[model samples]
Structures are given as C-alpha cells and as structure tokens.
Target: MGLGKQDRTKAREELAHDQERAERLPELLRSVAEAERALDEARERGALVEEVHEQGVRLDTALTEAMRAAYARERVLVGVGGYTDRIRRRKRLARPEIKQATQVAEHLLTVREAHRLHGIQQAPRSVV
Candidate 1:
C-alpha cells in the first residue's frame, strides 16, 4: 500500500528539508574552504597544539556538515580512499606542520571530489 497521510506528510517535510540543504550547498562549501584555509595557516605558522587542534576541529565540523548536506541531496556514498593510512604515513614522517595541513587538505579534497562526482552522476545521459 501507499504511504498513509502522516507518513506522506513526514516524507514531504523531509524532502523539503533536503531541498533546503541542497540549496545551501554552495554556502557550506565556502565555509569548509575557509575552515580548511584557517587550519592550514595555523599549522604552517607553527601555532600551539591547542590552537591547531581547534582549527582542525572547525575544519572537520565544516566538512562533516557539507558531506551530510551533499548526501541528503544525492543519496550516494563518496569514497575517500586511504585517508587514515595517508594521515598515519604523514604523522610517521615527523613533520607536524605538514601532517596537520595534509590532514585538513585531504578532507577538503575528498569533499570537493564528492561534490564533483555527485554532479557527474546527476548529469543527463544521452540516448544513441
């Protein structure tokens, strides 16, 4: 059977919420970019560990929100390959600044790639 009235209403509300988030995707991306930049600068400047951690947290939160919104819009899984391993490798190199910056940059790159892939997936396919 089809959805009942309450279920239909809930579905409609969810759809509308997703649509709103989709509309804000651009803004969210900008915020993520800004956060990434701030984190990178903090790391590069040899800021205190606590300061760098704060900036990293900000970037992480922004990336997470952006990904959530993108998923809501596209309903697809985006793979960021080997992120943990890459971070571990960087950490093992003993370059704290580079490791921190790389961690933030990697996340930002993954989010951008997710958006790009979603766009490609949503593109209209041609018929022969």
Candidate 2:
C-alpha cells in the first residue's frame, strides 16, 4: 500500500534528523582526534618517567658496586706502606666514578619528576 500523509510526514522527519547528525559528524570526529592525541601524550610521558627511573636505579647499582670494590681494596692494604699508596690511587679513581653515578641518578630523578608533572598537567578535563 502507498504511504499515507501521516506516514509521509514521519519519514520526512526521520530524514531530517539523520541529516542533522551527518552535519555534526566533522565536529565529533575532531573531538575524537583530540582525545586520542591527549592519550598518546600521556602514554609517552609515562614511558619517559619509567625510563628515567630505570636509569637511576642502574646508576645507583653501579655506584654501590664501585664502592664495594674500593672498600675491598682498602682492606687488602692494611699495614704495607707500598700497598697503601696503591690503595690511595685506587680510591681516587673510584671517587670520580662514584661522584658521576650520584650526579646522574639525581638528574634522572629530576627528569622523572618533571615528566610526571607534565603528564598531570596534560590530563584531559571532563566536559561535563
């Protein structure tokens, strides 16, 4: 059967609604794109923080190992004058390595904190 006048009016109304939604498609797409970009940035920041922390841990471990070696060298030199000089030279060499490791670990911690703050700042706010 052919559509009655009421049916025809309902069909026109539905078509208009669909057209309106289609017109809003670009805006919706842009919003989705922005959300995705924000998510990507947050992930990148988190990764950077993790990387920095790992580096700090590695540096700390190296410093610990170097100190252990220096202590062992000192203990072995207890009462010999000639060997005491060798121990001093070994300690002097280890001192720079320890210092460098300490500096690098501190710097990495600072970098991690900065990245964490950046991630928090970039967090997307709800539109509600």
Tell me the whole-model lDDT of each prediction, alpha carbons only. 0.58, 0.44
- Once model 1 is optimally superposed onto the true structure by TM-score, how far is the C-alpha of residue 100 displaced, in angstroms? 29
lDDT of 1 by residue, 1-128 (tens): 44467765665666667667756767888998898788788878887767766776676677777766665444211112122234544444455554543444456558656644441222234479
TM-score of 1: 0.58
TM-scores, each model vs. reference: 0.58, 0.35
| Candidate 1, position 75, lDDT | 21
lDDT of 1: 0.58
TM-score of model 2 (CA atoms): 0.35
Tell me how far candidate 1 lies from the true structure as C-alpha RMSD in angstroms: 20.3
Error of 1 at 38 (Å): 0.7
Off by over 4 Å in 1: 75-128
- In candidate 1, residue 4 scores what lDDT? 65
